[model samples]
Target: MERPQNMSIAPRIAVGVIILFHAVGLVGLSLPATRPLFLQVVPWHLLLMLLTIVFGHYKLSGRFKAFILVVFWLGFFAEWIGVHKGWLFGNYAYGTTLGVKMFDIPLMIGVNWFLLVYSAGVTMQRSGLKNGFVRVVTGAGLLVLLDVLIEPVAIKFNYWQWIAGSIPLKNYACWFLVGAVMLYVFELFNFKKQGIAAPALLITEFVFFGALNLVIGLWPL
Candidate 1:
């Protein structure tokens, strides 16, 4: 039996920061004056999220390190191909709001991908689901739904622009495909199902984007 005295406080701390930052971000981005400043912090927000999830894991073994590298580079390259070749998520271009660019894609975009996919993986992993395929599909579905909410907010904030100002069905479909592939990578790894931080982050992501959609829809800012 584990003792409460031995419990790590890192997950709790991470969760608190996740909630605090996202709440601040949502409010800051909703207003006219603070929007740009908040948007500038978006990459740092992503990095913070990545760090929290990394901290939640606590024990970084070789395979786990491999998982991080694979996801980061794979996500970066996928976006590279998607942006330059217009293959993966359709014809959308990133904006300057996300920060510095490599091949016109923000370096932090990979961090964004890792954050989304990892949280989805952890959420589904703890969902009491028994099959790998089901977890992958469900997690991917969750991300697609979040993307539906995110598209408008992303566009309004200039995170990325869809070609001709129209988002395609192709984008959502590819989000599912790519998300599932990443979740599949997650499943192949064996990590302890001990942290609420990932699930909290995932739920907070939905809340952040969903709340922004509602706020933006009402106010048009």
Candidate 2:
């Protein structure tokens, strides 16, 4: 069956609710009185965000499921190596604010990688960019850009810490490389694009983190 051009009301409402919830949460986080309570909710927030993306891809084909699995594992492994060996993403380590972890990498990192690549890939596809290489590269670029926004906020929120009190260039380089490969795999799988959740979540994250970065001004920089 062909995908609908517009998202259905159910998914749209879900996305709207998530956005509103996060927007309010961010506001709460900005105040010292609510900051602790907001930090405690960070893990659940990440889980809910991942759930929104999954809901967007509901009823998708097995190929898409396989794609998500591969991306998730690859992302986890990359982070595992980065945290232990300091290879892919430079010498950085996650903090407790993100909640539970395995192998010193927060489980949410894997989910985040999948969500970012999927959202970026769908966005490129929606942009009417027909060339596979262009789509992959552009999507990866977008991922890197998002990371630029997230890095500072991450540090400020104690989600992760960098070795030298600054984000390393290699970290962004790794993001671009891995993001490109993941988006390429997304193109290879040819997953059908449906609903507004992907783009909405992506844009929401961008604005959310971007605003945080602006307001916080890169702490410890």
TM-score of each: 0.94, 0.91
lDDT of 2 by residue, 54-95 (tens): 756746566767888999998999899898998888998899
Model 1, residue 210: distance off in Å is 0.6
What tens-digit string does per-residue lDDT give for candidate 1 at 1-221? 22224234467787899999999988898889888788889888888888777867746568777998889988899899889999888998999888899999999988888888888998998899999999999999999999999899889889999887899998999999989988998988866675778889989999999999999889986
Best by lDDT: 1
The top-ranked prediction according to TM-score is 1
Mark the 10 consecutive residues where model 1 has the least summed lDDT.
Answer: 1-10
- Candidate 2: where are CA atoms >4 Å away? 1-9, 218-221
Q: Estimate the TM-score for candidate 2.
A: 0.91
